[model samples]
Target: MNQLNVCLSPALIPLYNVEDHIVVIIDIFRATSSICYGIENGAEAIIPVSLVEECAAYREKGLDYLLAAERDGKVVEGFDFGNSPFSYTKEKVAGKTVVLTTTNGTHALHLSRAAKKIVIGSFLNLTSMCDWLKLQNDNILLVCAGWKNNFNLEDTLFAGAVVEQLKTGDFKPDDAAIAANDLYQLGKHDLNEYLKKTSHSERLKKLGIEKDIEFCLQVDLITAIPVLDGEMLVKLQ
Candidate 1:
């Protein structure tokens, strides 16, 4: 692995000296997409909470919040909204604040407590995330929200997308991204088919969110970069 810092999960990422690497968090299924929508449509800020209770707590702190959460591909109880970009329509969320929680994405944000700087990544902002990474100092870590603390292809594939773009940078792409880039290059001709092979696709199909999968798999439709400053993910200026 060399001096290239890499961690699959925040829970597993050892606490060490990593004040330099760019930490890109990927939740390709939906959370990042929703983040894209919120930032693109002029939402004030999106605070990502690891738990529903956390979101509620933030709302109670006089934030004037819209609570959004999702679990197992469905909305959670006692929340203002769910994890869908469609729900973040400009008409509904523009000029407002949001507290977001998700089964995977927000949890991933919470886990990276030791990251130097955390940025949300998805197909939509693939280029922006990488371009930002290119401008940072040496070393980079791609934290993937593996399904239930296990290896997940979709997250890694998104990481690979970043690696592909940083080919000539002073970055140390993890081996996971190496393999992921291989898969991405091989199936790039029919990305949908490749995405269907991921565990997320199976779960989405079972949850009847095949359409969501389609929406998430749409690449490069947006350039909005959602950056995590503490628990809140806001538009990257």
Candidate 2:
């Protein structure tokens, strides 16, 4: 049986890869969700960076692109946008590059680079994400985009949702999965109930994008799996 481990928060993420495993990245607080939405709506590509400077370097290239990032739940200085999926429209993202960074999710993406395959996960594409991950031949790791190295409810809930789907697929889970699976089961049918109390939700409310919170919490609304293809993430079109 292949081992399945869940990293409870992005803060715990650094570099831990199984010999040949798949990585499922969850960042429901909008970065990963926006990428999934962009790809589903016909985005060309998304490049996630770990640092503001690295994201800035891509911006300097002057590609037909949208500059997006956030710090402390607010748009960074001079950035065209913050990390909200609502800003990624077909008119804005179509045939254009998106260089993205966030307080948590983008860093988690880089931290999970060692895996043989890195797949983005969010409520927007949960079923397809699990289906794609099930096809991988090795172990699986679910990396949660927690709140700045701190534990957050929404990410772990999403991770649990994945574990619940993959629990019987020759994937022997670790202790973290135990908690994640339990948490997921408790909140699957009422995710919004659980998410409302999360730090991400409060931050979103503070930013005045309450609708996006509603958008992100609706499970299985999308099934387009967004996978990392080299430096840029795109749909397997």
Report the number of the highest-TM-score candidate: 2
lDDT for each residue of candidate 1 in 1-237, tens digit (9 for 90 to 100):
223444565466555344555567777777777788787788888877677777778756876788887776677777788887788888988888888786676666666656677777888777777777777665777777776667777777777677788766665555665787776787667767887766556567888877766777777777778777765678888
Clashing pairs in 1: none
lDDT of each: 0.72, 0.80
Backbone clashes in model 2: 1
| Model 2 Cα lDDT, one tens digit per residue, 1-237 | 888889887656554553366888888877778888888877788888777778778766877777887776678897877777887878778887888886577677777777787888888888888887777757888888787777878888998998999997988898999899999998988898877776556667777877777788777777777788988898865
- Residue ranges of candidate 1 with Cα displaced over 4 Å: 1-6, 15-17
Candidate 2 regions exceeding 4 Å error are 71-78
User: Per-prediction TM-score, please?
Assistant: 0.88, 0.90
Clashes (backbone N, CA, C under 3 Å), per candidate, total: 0, 1
